[model samples]
Structure formats: structure tokens, C-alpha cells
Target chain A: MSSVDRSQRSNSTLKTLNRVFVYTILIVSSLMMLIPFAWSVITSLKSNENVFTHSAFWLQFPPDFSAYKEIWNRIPLLKYTANTLKVAVIVTFGQLFTSSLAGFAFAKMKFPGRDKLFVIYLATMMVPGVVLLIPNFVIMRTIGAIDTHWALILSAVGSVYGTFLMRQFFLSFPSELEDAAKLDGCNPFMFYWHVLLPNAKPILTTQGLMAFQFIWNDFQWPLIVLNSESKRTLQLGLSYLMSEYYTDWTLLMAASVLTLLPIIILFFIAQKNFIQSFKLSGLKG
Target chain B: MKKNRERSPRVSLLAKNKIREALWGYLFISPNFLIVLIFTILPVFFSSYMSMTDWNILSKPNFIGLENYQHILQDEVARETFFNTFYFSVLSVPVSLILSLLFAVFLNQKIKGIAFFRTAYYIPCISASVAVSLMFMWLLANNGLINQMLTSFGLGPVKWLTDPKIALNSVIGITIWKGLGVNIVIFLAALQDIPPELVEAASIDGANRVQQFFKVTLPLLSPVIFFVTITGVINSFQSFDLVYNMTKGGPGHATTLIGYYIWKQAFDYLHMGYGAALANLVFFAIFILTIIQWILRKRWVYSEE
Candidate 1:
């Protein structure tokens, strides 16, 4: 009995030690993860004199707001930001509308060739975005959309991933809701607009937030499509800030901070939903 | 007019409703179908044909058949890019998989301040890849923070980006760093899906912590592990953004992975045909890998009884 009691006491100590170890690891790793961003933020706030040094983030009690003002004045940052906002908003709403409607169709409606078509859509997603670059460029050029936001907006408006996400959500929905809507003499579009869409807030939020994140952060497609100075997105603007002409580290960092501002705000505002959707999508995958 | 296109059978209410539902379904999916057909579907065929031509984005693509394919075989730069891509994926995917799984296991503990840790980690993932790359560009510079920290420790400053030998590896490190949070969350979600009773059962059966983790926990996490692996492979292979922003495949083309190479070939040098061919090759390789993984999943993934 004494031996068992001693072992149990030792086990409790071991568990406590394990808990401490876990906390230590988590703290260290989170710090490591945050340092780059923190450094960027610090660099953005620092003066140009000692911007590259270790003391830049520390010695300065209050950081200078000069770089933030300079980045905006030097570059058409507000314009670039407006461009990015326009595209991201349009693309997000566009994807949400198109994908949700199609998702409802795929999930709730019985149509000929439904399964086959959805399967084809799934298969097409495996085609790497890189493979589409040359051909899409040619297509965009052919349609006279080069150096325009239309190139970015048009190609991105249709997304199979969003559709797949919404389809998965709608598949789990009960058919009884649809039957009740139909009993009230609702047409298909009315049922979709009134009953289905009202209940689809959760899925729509998930898809919209994801779409916004994706479009806002997208760099490659914008790089390929847009070239005119006035039409540059925040990503291109940031890249321009980092270009050979401008080696202003603080300026670029400032641009990055501004670029990250909206997303960071969005993440905080929608943090719960964002994390929840991520977990759900992870499970779905 | 639309009704005339389809045979209107004025039969039972159910049949008519089915027809109406089908028509509505068709209408609902039309916008998506058109876009998919134009942007996604058409490109596959257009690019495949473009791969056989010598299109310079100027004149009409002159059909040159398998010549582009032949050139890609002999092209030393293409070979290097392919090798770099393979090297990046081979290193990055496994390291990330293991690290994410380990952290995820530790994080699965119901500790106070777990949400804060999760948010902190996810902050990197939320930022634009370009932004992350830009931050790291300075961070990994010779006189940057990392080397500064190293110098304080009495170690020599290593060139993180410029050196040919270490540039791709540095990019790989950055890739893993930015991606670790999302992967951890994924694994965390998967870990949470496991029943506590299973772990309890393992513990009661005289299994230690490590044993419980390996025996009971791992099998359940296999599906997510595989999912991460496939995505990791795909992302690493097509990892253009970081390289584009950080190194621009510089230092003697050392960091030029296939995606960057394809872009340079098609857009920069106007070797659209060769670019298309290289893109196809990547697609084919990824396609094969995905199929192989799908087939092999049954071997280890725990299917429900």
C-alpha cells in the first residue's frame, strides 16, 4: 500500500513537470513565431539611422511615425490599397455568390450529370495554378485585359474550393427545410434566397472570410496580370517598395505593416470563426 | 422559349417538380460552369497544345511538336530547377510534418492561454506570403537580426540568401516557419477528434505517455498527416511567392524552383512553349504522386470498421 501511494505521488509530480515543460515549449515557440512580425513592426516604426540594428526595436521609447507617412506620400499607397480592396471585395462576394448557388444546386437539387460534373470540378482543382499561368495570360491578353484589374477579378471569381466547402456544408443540411419551403409555394430561386440563404450564414461567413483572405494575400496572379503602376495591388505595391530602385527597409516594412493591417484586423474581429473554419476545413481535408 | 428546349411532360406533380428542380439546378450552376469552362477547363487543353508550339506571346504559336520537350530534357537550368524543387519538397515536407505533429500534440493539452498561443502562431500564416518573405529578407540578411543574434553568441555570420549552396535551404526554412502554425492547427484539430477514452484506455493498459501517443494517437492522426503531406508536396513544388520575393531565384539560379522557372521562361524570356511543357511535367508528376498516395493510403490510414 505504501509503495502504491509513493508511486502515485511521484506520478503527480511527473505530470506537473510535464505541464511546465509544455508551457515552456509553447511560450518559446510562440515567441519565435512572432519575432519576424514583431521585428517588421519595430522596423516600420524606427528611424532610418539605426533601423537595421538590434537596438532599433528596444532603445526607442516611442517609435517615429515618419516612415508610415513617407511610404504613403512616396507611393500611391491609398490608391493601391483601394485597388486591392476593390478586387478582394469583388472576388470574395463573387465567389460567395457563385459558389453558394452552385453548392446549393450540387447538394440539394437532383440534376442529370450532377455527380459526374462535381467529380470533374474536384479533379480540375488538382491542376496546379502554375500550369494555368501561360495559357491564362494568353487568354487574358487575347481578351484585351492585360494591365487591368479585370484579369485578376475575372479569373478568380469562380472557385471550385469554395463550392466544395459550401457543398459539404449544405450536404449535412436537412431536406425537411426545403420540403417546408416548397409547401409554401416557393420557387427554386425564392427557396434559395429566402429559406436556404438565411440558414447558410455560417457557411457563407466561412467562405467569404476565406475568399477575402485568399484574394487579399494573392501575389502571383496579380504579378502575372497587372503591370501598370496605377493598377498595382497592395502586394505589388509592397514588392515595388522592395524593388531595386527602393532599398528603404523601413519604408518596405511600413508598407508591409499597412498591408497586413486589414488582415490582422479581420483576423482579430473574426478570429473565432476563422479558427473554427480552419479546423473544420482541416477535418474535411 | 426555354421551355421549348426541354420536353415538357405535364405529368405527375413529382415529375414536374423534378424537372423544375433540374432546370433550376442547371440555371444555378450555369455561371460557375461558364467560368470554369473558360478559365479552368479551356486552359488545360490550350496549355497542352501551347506546350507543343513556339509561342513568344507575339505572333501566332508556331506548332513545333516535341522539340520543346526535347529541349527541356537537355536544358541544364530546367534540370537544376527540377532538382531544387525536389530538394525543397523532400526536406521541407517531412520536417514540417514532424514538427507540426509534435507541437500539435503538446498544444492539444487543455492548458490556460492555449488560445493566445494559437493566435500568436497563426499570425504568421495570416500575413501575406509576400509580406512574410519581405520580413525574412531583412531578417535573414547577412547583417540582419538572425546573424546579429548569432554574432552576439560569438558565432560567425552566415549568408542566408546570397550563397548558392544555402539559399534554397534558407527559403525552405522560411516556408516551414510560416506554414508550421496552420499545419499545427490541422493536426490539433485531428488530435481533438480522437476520443479521450482511447487514451485513457491506453493509460489504464499500462501504456506510458509516449506509448499512448504512438500506439493510440498516431493511427487516428494518419489521415490528417497524409492530407498535410499531399498539400506540403504541392505547396513546396509550386513555392514561387517566397522565392520570388526573397531571392528572385538569384545567386546563380540556385533558388529557382520549377514554378519560378516556368514563370521566367514564359513571361520573362517569352519561352511560353517551354514553360507550358515544364508546367505540364510538374502537373504530371504531382498527379502521379497524388494517385500513388491515394492508393497507398489504405495501407496505413485507419478506416472505420
Candidate 2:
């Protein structure tokens, strides 16, 4: 009896030891994970003198905003933010519209050669964006969208992944909802607009957020498309932070903080959805 | 007799409505399909044609069958970039998967403020990669904060960027950092979805935590792992933003990834056809890898047919 008791006690101790180890690792790793972003924010608030300090983390509280104020003339930060916001918002709504229409048709209605067409769309999903880069450039130039936001917008306004996701979502719906609409003598467009769309708020938001985040953070396509300073997105503009004249670490960090703010807020507001969307994507396998 | 007489018109009316529904389906699908056909589908075929030519931005493409493809055979930088990307996927993808898996296992516990911890864990992923890469570029430079701290601690200052091997590794580390949170979140959601009673049943059968993780949980988690790996490899192939923003494929072409190399060829060197050929190579490589993974999926991935 005593031996059993002792063994039980030792097992409890081992469990406690494991708990401590887990928390310690979690805390340390998380702190390390956050340090770079935290430092970006801190460094942005630092004066030029403190920013160049030899210490890895020089703390400066009650920050000066001179760099933030000076960053306007330093770069076209406002114009870039506007461009990103405009593109992101338009792409998000546009994708939501285009994807839902196709999704509804694919999920609820039968058509000629539906499955074959979707397979073709899925086949192209594996093609790397770079493979299309040269041709898309020529196409864009030929279409007179080379230096315009239309190059970013019209192309990004629809995606095969978005359509596929929305289709999967629409397929999950109960048939009674559509049957009811049909019984009510609702036409296909009316049923799509009223019955189907109202039920798709969750997926619509997920798709919207995904589209917004993707467009907001994208750099490569915009870099290839936009030439003039006035037309550049935030990322493309920030790439010039290390200009030939001088490199302003403060301005760059400050701009990063600015660019990251909206995404951070969206995460806070709808983090559960963000997480759920990721899980939904993982379930694609 | 009168009711039976009415049924024929109703049947014809229903058949007429079926045609209308099919018409609506086609109408709804057209805009979406057209965009994809124009931008994605057509470009792929166009890319094939472009890859067969020799062209600069100045002149029209001169059709030179297979010359660009042949040039890729001897391109030293191309081979190096290919290896660089391969090592990148080999090193970083598995590490991210494992670390995220571990985090998911550990953090699956019931604890207070776990939600906040999860949020904090996922913040890095949502920020722009260019922004994050730029931040890391500054931090990992030779005279950067990290080296400064190393010197202050009396340790040798590692050349994080200058040395080609270390430069690539440093980018790998940062990429892992930026993406780790995302995988962790996905893994966390997946872990939560697993029925807890399965783990309990394994424990009841005398399996310990580690044993149960290996025996019970791993199989259930295989599908998510498969998805992560496929996506990771796909993203790894397009690994340009980090290399471009951080290292610019620097120090004697050490960091030049395939995407960066392709971009440089077309935009910087005006070798549009050569770039298209390189892109074609990537397209075929990914297509083949995807097919192989799909074929192998049924072997290991649970609940997948």
C-alpha cells in the first residue's frame, strides 16, 4: 500500500514538472515571437538618437512623433495607404460578388458541363503566378492597364479558390431553404439574392477578410504593375525606404506599424472567424 | 378525369422552369469563369508560347524553339537558386510543421487567458510579409541588433547576411517566424476538432501522453499535415518577397530564389522569353509534385478517400 502511495505521489510530481516546463517554453517562445513586432513599434516611437543605440532594445516612453510627422514629405505614405485601402476594399467586395454567384450556381443548380468546367478551373490553380507574370504583363500593357490600378483590381476581382470555397459552403446548406424559395415562385436571381446570400454571411465575411488581407499585403504584382509614385501601393512604396540618399529606419518601422494596424484591428475584431477560415482551408485536404 | 387532364400542362411548365434554372446557372457562372479564363487559363497557354521564343522588351519575340529551355540546362544561377529553394523547403517546412504541431499539442490544454495567448501567437502572420521581411532585414544585418547583442555578450558575431549559407538560413528562420503563428492557429483549430474522448480512450488503454500522441493523435492529424505540407511547398517555390526584401539575392547569387531569378530575368535583364521558360519549369514541377502528393494522399491521410 505504501509503495503504491509513493508511486502515485511521484507521478503527481512528474505531472507538475511537465506543467512547469510547458508554461515556461510557451512564455519564452511567445515573447520571442512578439519581440520583432514589439521592437518595430518601439523603434518607430524612438527619436533618431535612441534608435541608433547599441543596445538591442532601447526603451523610450512618452514617444516623440517627429518621425511620424516628418514621414509624410519623406514618402508618399498617405497616398500609398489610400491606394492599398482602395484596392483591398474593392477586391474584397468584388470577389464576394463574383465568387458567390458562381458558388450558388455550382452548388444549387445543374447546368451543362458544370463538373468538367470546375475541374478545368481547379487544374489552373496549380499554375504558379510567376508563370503568368510575363504574359500578364504583355496582356496588361496591351489592354492599357500597365500603370493603372485596374491591373491589380480586375485580375484579383475573382479567384478560383474563392469560388471553390464558397461552393463548398453553399453545398452544405439545407435543400429546404432553396425548395421553399422555389415554392414561393422566386426566380433564380431573386432566390440567390434573398435566400442564399443571407445565409452566407459567415463565408462571405471569411472570403472578404481573406481577399482584403491578401490584397493589402501583396507586393509583387503591384511592384510589377505600378510605376509612378502616385500609383504605388503601401508595400511598393515602403520598398524604397532604403533609398540611395539615406535609410531611415524610423520611417520604415513607423510605416510598417501603419500598414499592420488595420490587419491587427481586424484580427482583434474577428479573430475567431480568421482562425475558423484557416481551419476551413486546412480541411480542404 | 379533369385533374388528370390538368397534369400535362403542369409537367410542361415545370420542364420549362428547369430550362430557365439552367440558363440562370450559366449566366451566374459566366463572369467568374470569364475572369479566370482570361487571366489564369489563357495566360498559362500564352506562357507556353512565350517560352518558345527569344525576345527582349524592345523587339518582337523571335520564335526559337526550345532554345530558352536549353539555356536553363546550363544556367548556373538557375541551378543554384533551385537548390537554394529546395533546401529552404526541406529545412523550413518540416520545422514549421513540427513546431506548430508541438505548440498545438501543448496549448490544447485548458488554461485561462489561452484565448489571448492564441491571439498573440497569431499576430505575426497577418502583418504584411514585405513589412515583416523588411523589419527582419534590419534586425539580421551584419551590424544589426542581433549581432550587436552577440558581441555585447562576448559571443562571436555571426555574419547573418554576408555569408551565403547563413544568409539563406537567416531568411529561413525569419520566414518560419512569420508563418509559424499561422500554422499554429490552424493546428490548434484542428486539434480542438479531434474528439477528446479518443485521447481519453487511448489513455484508458494504458497509453501515456506521448504514446497516445503518436498512436492516436498523429493519424487523425495526418490530413491537416498533408495540407500544410502541400501549401508549404507551393509557397516555398514562390519565395521571393523575403529574398527580395531582405537580401535581394545577394552575396554572389546565394539567396536568389526561383521567383526572384525569374523576375530579375524578365524585368531587369529584359529576357522575357527566358523568364517565361523558367516559369514554365516551375509550373510543370509544381504540377507534378501536386500529382504525386495527390496519389500518395490516400495512403496516409486518414478520413480521405
Residue A217, model 1: Cα distance from true site in angstroms? 0.6
Query: Candidate 1's residue-wise lDDT over B1-305, tens digit each?
Result: 77654545544656977888899999999887788889999999999999999988777889999999999989999989888988999999999999889888888888899888999888888889888888998887777788878887899889899989889899999999988888987888778778899999999999999999889998777777888898899887788999888888989999999999999999899989989999999889888877776676767665421
Candidate 2 C-alpha lDDT tens digits along A67-123: 788778778788888999999999999999999999888888987898998888778
Q: Model 2: how large is the Cα RMSD against the reference?
A: 2.1
| Global Cα lDDT for candidate 2 | 0.84
Best by TM-score: 2
Using Cα atoms, each model's DockQ against the true complex is 0.68, 0.69
Q: Give the CAPRI class of candidate 1.
A: medium
Best by DockQ: 2
Kindly list the per-residue Cα lDDT of model 1 for residues A1-285, writing each as its tens digit.
Answer: 999999999999999999999999899988999888888888878787766554432555587889888876788988998999999999989988899899999998999999999999888878888889989999999899999999999988888888887888888889998899789998889988888888989878877888889889999999998989999998988887788435577888888888998999999999977886666556433
